[model samples]
Target: MTPGALAEGRPEARGPRFRVVVETGPDARQEIPLEGTLLVGTQVEGGLRLSDPTVSRVHLELQARPEGVRVRDVGSRNGTWSLGVRIHEVTLAGEARFTLGKTTLLVMPEPTEEAAEPAPRTTFGRALGQSAAMQKLFGVLERTARSSFSVLLLGETGTGKELLAEAIHRASPRSNQPFVIVDCGAVVPSLIESELFGHAKGAFTGAHADRRGHLVQADGGTVFLDEVGELPLELQPKLLRVLESGTVRRVGDNAAKDVDVRVVAATHRDLKAEVAAGRFRADLYYRLAVVPVRVPALRERAEDIPLLARHLFQQAGQPDFPLTEELVQRLMGYDWPGNVRELRNFVHRVLAAGDAELPDTRPVSAVTAAEDLSGLTFKEAKERMVEAFTREYLTALLARCGNNISEVARTAGLARSHVHGLLNRYGLKAGD
Candidate 1:
C-alpha cells in the first residue's frame, strides 16, 4: 500500500515538498508523499509497501529537503540504481529515476496546485511542445513569420532551430518559393564564397561553367544558414554587403547581381562573445540578428517529454508500442543534454529492443549501429553499448582533466574509488 498524499504532521502545516512516484511493479503509478524519513520495501510497516518479490523488507529510505530529496539504500540485497549507475546514497536536486529489483521509482518535487492540471500540447509547423517556454516561442515565431526580418535562431545544438527556420519560411509570403539550406560548417572554406555568392566561368579551376550561388538560388525565397557562426571571417564583409544592398557579387566577378532573399541564421555560439573575441564581425552579427528567437532545450521543457516520446515512437513506426506511465516517468527524469535529437534516437533504440523501458544514458556516439544489433541478445547489445559509452566518456574526461584521477572523479560526480574501479574494469590507466 502507498502512503497517503499528505505526511503525518501538524494540522496547519503545508503539504509535503516532494513525492515519490512508483513507476513500476505491484505499486505502479502510486504517488506517495515524502514528509520525512519514508521507508520503502515489501514490509507492511514501510510507507511504500509492495508485493514485488525482489524488494527487500526494508529496502530504501528517502528524506525530503527544501533543495531536493536524499535517497539511501538500506542494506538492500540487489542495491539501487539511478539512471544506470548503482548507488548507496545520493542527493538528487532534481527529478531522478531509481530502480530496485524490477520496480522503478521517480523522486521529484511536488507539482504546484496549478501545475497539477495538464496543458494541451501545442504544435507549430512540424515542431510540437506544450511547456510555457514553447508556448512563448510559438508566439514569437508567429509574429516573426508575418514579417521579412532576417531572423536569428539561437539555441543549443539539437534544439530544432532548422525546423523553426523552415516553419518561418513556410508561413511567410515565400511559401511557394525555394527554401535553401546552406550548412556553413559542412561546406569547404575555400569554396564557400563561390557556393554562397555565384561564380562565373573560368573564375577558378573548378569554375568550368557559370554557377549561381545559394543566395541567387534562393532568390524570391529564404535561405537558412545552419551554423552561420562558422562563416569565414574573410567573407563576412562580402556577406554584409549582400544583406545590405540586396545584391551578390560572384567570386572573381566585378558585377553584382540582384538577389531578393530573406535570411534565417542559426548557431549554438554566442555571437556577441565571438565579436568581442574578434572571431566574428560585429556588424554582420547585428545585421543577421535582426529578430532573434531562442529554441528552448529539452530539459527546459521537460513537461513535453512524454508527449514528445510518444510522438517519436510513433514516428519510428511503433504506433502500437506501449509507452507505460513508468516509461514516461523515466524519460522525464533524464536531463537530455543532447535535447530532442537524443530523445528521438532513444525512441528508435527502444523500438529496436522491443522491451527496453529505461532511458538510454549512453552518448549519441556510443549508440550501437543497428547492423551490430543483429544476432545479438538484448543483454549482449546493451553490454556492448555500455562498454563503448564508458570507454568514450572516461577517455574524453581523462583527457580533459589531464589524467588527474581526483579531477576526473569530481568532474564525473563519482568517488575516487569508483572512478578507479571503472578504470580498472575497463583496463584504462589514468596516464594512458
Candidate 2:
C-alpha cells in the first residue's frame, strides 16, 4: 500500500480507532458520528446518551494533526481524564477508559455486546427548543391531546401541520388505533363526500362494491383532514353532521352507522374570514375548532432552524456532513416562506445536487429571509440592530411613495395603525 492510503499497512495511514467516553452512568453508552461541534442523542435514566464535539479547544487544536483526528479534555463535572491526571473532558480513542460516577469501563472500536437494538428507523421525536411561542403551542397541544375534541390546526401550507396532527394522535389514548390521513385538498370536489362518508354497492358510476370511507376506517383512532378549508361549501353540512353526531351514512344508503373516531383538521385558510364571507359554515368551523392551534411559520421561530436542519439532514440518512456554522447561519437568517416542507426539499436538493461546501446559492428566491441575530448579546448591539432593521424598512417604504402614509403602509404590508405607531416611535414626520 502507498503512503497516505486508506489501507492500514500503508506508511502514513491510520486505522479507524477514534472513540469517545462519557462518564454518565452504569448504562451509559453513546456514539456520535464525528461531524459538528454538538453531539445528538437521547436522555436515558441516569444521564444523557450523548457526546460533545466541542469538549475542549484542544480538540480543535488537534484538527491540524496529520491523522485528521485528536482527543482533548473537556471541562465536565465527572471529569474526562484520558490517561490520568484530573482534567475536564477528553477526546478519546479506541480502547479508552470510561467513568460514570464511580463505575469504570472500556470503549472499543468494535461494537459492544448489547441486546437493545436501536429503533429500525429515525423518528422525528418532535421539534424541541426554548422559544416562548413554541412553549405556548406545546402547552396547548398537551392540554388537548387526550380529550376527544377535534383539533383545528391553522398554518400555511408546508408548515408541518400534518406532522403536528400525527404527534397529537401518537400522544393520545387512541395511539394504538389506526391513524388515517385524508388530504381534503387533493380529493376532487365531486368525490369528497363519497370518499369521506364511504359508499354502498352501486352507489355511483365508480362504485361497484361497498367500501368504507376514511372516517369509518379511522374508527377508534384519528382521522387527520389536511386542507380542511378546501372542502366545498355545500359539502360542509354533511361533515358538520358527522362531527355533530358520531354517525356517517354511506352514499346511496339511507341508514347511518355509528363510529368512534377523533377528527384532526388542519388548513392554511383564515377560517374566521371564511365564515364571515359565508364561504365556510360557521357550525362546522365551531365543530372542528373545539381547540384551535396556530402553528407558527418557520420565519417566526428562526432560533430553531439549525436544530431542525440538522435533524432533517440526519433523517435523510446521511450520517455525517459539514453543515458549517456559516451555512447554518445563512439558513437561519433566510426567510423560509415555504416553511418545513421547503426546508426538507432543500436538504433533499443539497444531498442530491451539491457537495459539503454547497455553492453560494439557495433552493428558493434569495430573499433576506432569517437574519442571523443569534450571537448578539442580550443588551447593546442587539437592540440597535433590530431598531436599524425596523427603521430602515419603514423609511424605505415611506420614501418609495410620495409621503403618503396610507400607501406606504399598504406597500410595506403593515396595518395603518401599526404604521402610525412606527411613525410616532421613530419620531418621523410625513415628509421627513
| Per-residue error (Å), model 2, residue 421 | 43
Tens digits of per-residue lDDT for model 1 on 1-432?
A: 011111111121343365677767877757676767789889848498878899898998888755567889999999999868988988887456789999988775553211112224498789999888887677667656766767788897678888899988998999999999998876778999999998999999979999999999999999999989889999987898898678988888899889999899998777879887988976577567656667788888999998888888788887787878887787888767657876776676666765454434556454566446767898997888788888878865664454667657755768789999999999999755
Taking the tens digit of each residue's C-alpha lDDT, what string does model 2 give over 1-432?
A: 111121112233333332333434443433332322332222322322433432322221111133333433333344444446653434443234544334333333321111111222223226554455565556556546656667788886666777778888988899999999998866778999888999999998979899999999999999999888878999998887786568999999999999899889998788989887988975567557656678888779888777778788899998586788989888887766556765776687788877333223332223223555566676855676667667656654453443567656544657779889998998876655
**Which residue runs of candidate 2 sit more than 4 Å off their true CA positions?**
1-130, 355-432
Which 10-residue span in candidate 2 carries the lowest summed lDDT? 110-119
Q: Candidate 2 has what TM-score?
A: 0.54
Poorly placed runs, candidate 1 (over 4 Å): 1-121, 355-432
The count of residue-pair clashes in candidate 1 stands at: 0
Best by TM-score: 1
